[model samples]
Target: MSKLKNIFVFFGPPGSGKGTLAWLCVKRLGFVQLSTGSLFRRHINEQTDIGKQIDFTIRSGKLVEDSVVSKIVTEWLENAAHEHSSIILDGYPRTKNQAETLSQFLSEKFSSVKVCIVRLQISDEKLVERLGKRVVCAEKSCQKVYSLIENSSHKPKQTGTCDICVGKLIQRKDDAPEAVKKRLAVYHSHENELIDFYGENGVTIEDFNAADLVERIFEKFLCRFGFSIR
Candidate 1:
């Protein structure tokens, strides 16, 4: 049998640029990105039964059931699209139970699974500011990321418009100040659970600043992957 490969698990706040980093992992490093949020959104767009259930849970502002989520992800893993790909899991295994589910699944299916968890550390104050000022392209097909914060490279030349498609930039509902606070609260409540779980299970867990530029973080994480990849 082929040797098992290391899987990546990303932990961070919503606006901490985890998605951007995941994209870099896929584009530059040949890792397939698996984002549960995007998975839910895509299913909802397709109007499948699982998608509608997820849509209802999201509309009610509650986390999806752990078993359901794990099953959905497992199904995705077994799909032909990512059958032979290295995976970078974004926004998954939120609770201890969920993490356990993943562990059990890996053991049963792959014999052994190695994981490295990268936690993007950002202060609550910075998270609030970044999320609140965030805007994305209104065109679904060309949804590009942009920020009003001056430090961002994606900052538009004209402001409030996507540079690529000339589409209006829309702030996501979850980017509202109150919504951001709620998300931070949820993260804090369960953050230690995942951290402790990984540590006890002998998985490598590293924390890096989410406030850094994506390019800088990308460069740093590439080094982290160096020792593991080959």
Candidate 2:
């Protein structure tokens, strides 16, 4: 069996471009991205009982219950750890308790793997602007995210249409400006505590300023890790 190399934990609030950064790694570095948001979206799209619950919580700008989040993440990690050599974890461990739980689980199941915690730092003002302009494909299977901001590289070829699947684009309920502010508030409350927990556990947290272009961020990421696609 192939051993997992690095499990990248991407830390950032909503609209910080974590998904875009994850996509760049997937495209250029052949890493598998396990996005909790995408997983929740799948459940929500299916309208499962849990999906309904998650949908309600998300629409109200609240975090899903920790028990629900942990169960979903644990199941994902069980399969992904065995199948993928490298993985990027997007939006999983949001709070210090979740981080502690994840740390214990990884030690027990995949102790050999390296955990790389990267925190994307950006201003709340920038995040609000970004979220306000963000749109996603309406099709659940092709929920490609796009930015309507004039200077953003994630824009689709045609307005209001997905480039890959031609699905209609719409802003997510959680992406509303007011909802974004609420999400950011919740994030800031636990952000420092989560960082401190990792530090106390002897883990290094890599911080990156996310105001730069995606391409530039990708370049800096590679240089920091000295990673090569080839």
lDDT of 1 by residue, 1-230 (tens): 33347678988887788888889888776777777888888899999899999999989999899988998888776662335446878777888998999888887786555678989999999999988888989999999878898766778887888899899999998888999999899888788888998899988888889989887898899787673333
How high is the CA lDDT of each candidate model? Answer: 0.83, 0.86
In candidate 1 the C-alpha lDDT for residue 60 amounts to: 100
- What TM-score quantifies how close candidate 2 is to the native fold? 0.73
Per-model tally of clashing residue pairs? 0, 0
Instruction: Give per-residue CA lDDT, model 2, range 102-156, as digits (tens).
Output: 9998898888888888889999999998888999999999999898999677888
How does model 1 fare in lDDT? Answer: 0.83
Q: TM-scores, in order shown?
A: 0.78, 0.73
Q: Which candidate is the best by lDDT?
A: 2
Residue 101 error, candidate 2, Å: 1.7
